[model samples]
Target chain A: MIRKSPMKQENRQTISGADFEEYFQPQNLEKALEIKAEYSDQIEVAAGTTDLLVANYEQLHQIKNWLDLDKIDELRKIEILENELHIGAMVTHLQLMKSDLIKEKLAVLAAAAEDVGSPQIRSRGTIGGNICTSSPAGDLLAPLLSYEASFKLQKAGAERIVRAEDFFTGPKRNLMEADELLTEIIIPLTENEREGAWVKVGRRKALVISTLTLSVVLEFEADKIIEAGIALGSVAPTPIRLWEVGELMLGSSLTELDYKQLGQEVKARINPIDDLRGTREYREDVAADVMVRALNEIERKRG
Target chain B: MQITFTVNGEERELEVTPYTRLLDLLREDLGLTGVKEGCGKGECGACTVIMNGELTASCLVPAPQADQAEILTVEGLGTRDDLHPIQESFVEAGAVQCGYCIPGMILAGKRLLDENPQPTEKEVRYGLSGNICRCTGYAKIIDAVMMAADKLAVEGSDSND
Candidate 1:
């Protein structure tokens, strides 16, 4: 005997049978923005869809409108304009890894991109999606924050630039409005002698979420540290720039600096929790260790 | 939603639900079983496919986003009668222990070899890092890829001559 349960039927109905209302693939950013303005709250703007499609299917099934940004050529550009590197939000990790400009100016970001999930993930994951997803452990976030990158957020007729430091609210959260789309990332290029390092520790070399990530960029003026940009990921709610550590290192010579003291300050600044990848204490411990190691890399490079 | 894409040199137009993933669309709708779904999340590269000349996890790609895109699957590589060099190398090197991860491994090797015709052993390991094979301990798989690279290089030189 065949039986039909009421609860099963209702659950299937609530899931809507995996049917979505609309799917929009706009060729240009203008049409994309128009669609965004119209269905701001209803649309799910996908950049690469690497993380989006991997997310809960129930949420995706509930989506009223799907906006695919893959067709927007304007959003996939990487250009250098007037001392700033303008990378389109849809630029994939593979593009970043293979880009000559990124390798020349932002080797740290390229290193981070190379360490991301796998070749397949790197081919599909984008910098914009990395920022928008806003995972505290995002591989690229540490490098981005270290470079003082800013995002270009666009609505239909309005656009605003938000600094990387101020963009994140918490894990998997950002300062983006429902109507706004992240269009580009602008990193101001400096002419000074700059050396940077990206050091990440994970369970395995590939296809593993990082346990901790450290990005350090040091600007040197003939041996003395003119400026230091130190950022750590997976140690805080969001990938954070160590303002105290930066303040401590400014105008101090690397040779005369107190490595042990700086390590303590780095440990003190971050607040991590026990997760599957690592324990809170382990993250706090390595947070300092990797910082010192990354600084040492910068020191070695300076020589 | 309807998406038109080229799969393995053949153009296919199909009606897929908006929530459908490219993995499902390929396997269920298109009947390409070479693509496997081990982990729906991007961690496992079992569903890896070359989409528009790039290695991408089909599981993570929404079906609607594949519109007018070019895709390549393991089935497109070679038939049973005539095996691709990579497949031949895999069989010759005894890299097919479980055989579940062979498709993704071969695709990874293909992309790697396509970009770097002559890759070092370290490079081969790095290139195939995305694929996870539970059997054979990966030594044979790496050897298979290296052997395939040599075969592909020889074939290229012969064609040129």
Candidate 2:
């Protein structure tokens, strides 16, 4: 049996099932944004209802009026535009796996989706939820960050694209306002034809929270790496894209020796804290180890 | 809250709590006890059900969330008269020991086979990992999956989808 872990709250909020009411199910993006403008503070938008349930457990009444993003047909689409892959907020992990476009365009994303909680969780969990929730150890964010991802966040009457690098402020902390909802996660569809992979280390495989995870996107010119984008999760306040390490390996032959040193250098970039998953020092060490293993596998496959 | 859904090909409408789980709705309101609640969380696949072509944990799904969705439970998958091939494989392979986890295991296995008709051993193991059996009846269960795969391939009703 899965034990219930208490969350941090000043006082628990309780809403009876009898008190439950479904308020918003906007069919289109415009209507959803209009409702967001109207029901500003009380409304909580949800796609999968996974993260919201966790947050609701923490603060009982945090979800009083639900704006069901799942019902918004426009927000539930996956489109490949001219420059980037545009995945709507309501696109479930299962849908991503079924998309041949995802497999051909972004294989690392498909691999990361495969690592999310389990088959059940994957069916409901969305990439939008993964990014908007801003969990430091979220399975999908590191990979998205590795792809130089951004989000198209829509508010009452306006929208802006925020790069993944500037997306989150801290653990469970995002710049998302009460009125703004994430419409789509945008990843530039690279025509350069590079290969990327995601690796996660958790206690167990299914329904386990990731302890340390890494995503590496490498662009190889002939036999040398022209570009490398590496991101590490569960090692910082937010999942971080390791620009320094990527710059270090920009123009080098990625051998086993180089991978070992890069792992140590990536370790130096994070400030992991002691939490329920692992101690700070343990996370730091495991972060390095997972990175090394991930880099090794990617390099070996590249060869 | 009044909720309506197609359960096991039959349309069902019921009054339930918004917090009331789909598992609870199926067992209590509808009186279909096939869907078990081992872990009242998403971790356990005991409450697994195919909701609109995707297998999901019924425990985490609120009754309101399942409104207007098409759901298939273990009871609906096979009847006493005509059992699903996966169910038949379970019976033929002697996969059921305690029978407590059979419904869930069968549901998970059915979903796996539906998605990947000819899943390898590793794929089968990963698919069934969500459903736990205390009796350690995994070997027979694996055999059942393989047997069902071969049968489905023969029948051509396989999700070749």
Candidate 3:
């Protein structure tokens, strides 16, 4: 329940059409970068507009000038290169769920995408917008983190690739510079066969933010756990990779006891804060319980 | 900004502010009151509409986002004289209680049938998960969509035969 402040409404000026300086719909990447360079601070680059429009409606964002990126065809492509699967930043959740490449290679990501809002929300919500929002409870971030995804950020003259784990600096904040735009996500394909699962515990079946979420990716070699990636969300300031627990499980045949220890370790490591959705204690407990359940599910599948 | 888009199969050009949402544009500018605004946010599907053959929450969509896109609202579904099969099914199933959530529910049903003609009970429930109806307990709503699918399938096969 968001409380509307009467004083805030009174302070807002009635914005009319004349007040908008410009609405730039860039046709190509070059033009979009050029506009970004010129008015980086003044403009807001919109893709999907799922989070942005909601913020604007809630009076949380005061954006004026617009750079609509929906027309840029290159940013919406999902391609499979030699070494990695390249997902354009503008690719919507529905597109991700429908992609055979994603289903075959990144099954965890596909599952997470399917768990997102609803059919209507998924049609318009993009992977880029999800990353940009950087919410601690973002459904895709945990899966992407577990998959070791990297993001390509582009500015007017140069671009850089950053690891998904390093992209977040804090809640609702990332390493994106003022001039840089997140262009693509590259998930490197591994030689090792990986089995993974994504589980999100929310208030309801649909359109509810997660109270706690877990994404587990385990690589096995002949019934021995060769490698593992464990990521947790909504129990910390940012979605975090449980490296210690993953390291502990490596090279060991995971047993029921190992799963229990992993759950206890996860409960110890997470830093949950009390909030409206849940208490700190509840989140802490659920995080461990879900992590154990996910590992058990993965182990069962490996057989 | 002046934008041109096809609404209900008609080309419409309107000068709207950059901040204008599609929900406001539909209800206020175009006078299409059939599209309800339950929650200004995307949580509720009351503002659901089919844009470019995909279901979208109109409230979260900015007005310029609809430029050159074909939009289908409740008004486009059917007329009072000739209700769409799904709409008629809702009437036959007694799916309406308050009637506030019917438009979105009908649109969701249309999208489901368009993509999957023969949906299971679980699929129907998942298809309409975005829509929330405080009344009817959703059993009748599911029945309505299932009934519509059966009727459409029979009619479709009849046309081919």
TM for every model, in the order presented, reads 0.93, 0.89, 0.94
lDDT of 3 by residue, B83-138 (tens): 99999999999999999989999999999999999999999999999998978459
Which portions of model 2 miss their true places by more than 4 Å? A1-22, A54-62, A255-257, B154-161
Worst-scoring 10-residue span by lDDT in model 2 chain A: A3-12
Ranking by TM-score: 3, 1, 2
Per-prediction DockQ comes to 0.40, 0.27, 0.42
Tens-digit lDDT track for model 3 on A153-173? 999889999999999888999
The A-chain TM-scores of all the candidates are 0.91, 0.89, 0.91
Better of 1 and 2 by lDDT: 1
Ordered list by DockQ, greatest first: 3, 1, 2
Q: For residue A88, what is the lDDT in candidate 2? A: 89
1 or 3: which has the higher TM-score? 3
Stretches of candidate 1 off by over 4 Å are: A1-21
lDDT string for model 1 (A1-303, tens) is 211112212223334444444778889998999999999778788887878876755366766678889889999899999999999999999999999999989889999999999999999999999999999999999999989999999999999999999999999999999999999999999888888989999999999888999998888787778878899899989999987788888887889888778888999999998999999999988988887887788788877
Prediction 3 TM-score vs. true? 0.94
For candidate 3, what is the DockQ?
0.42
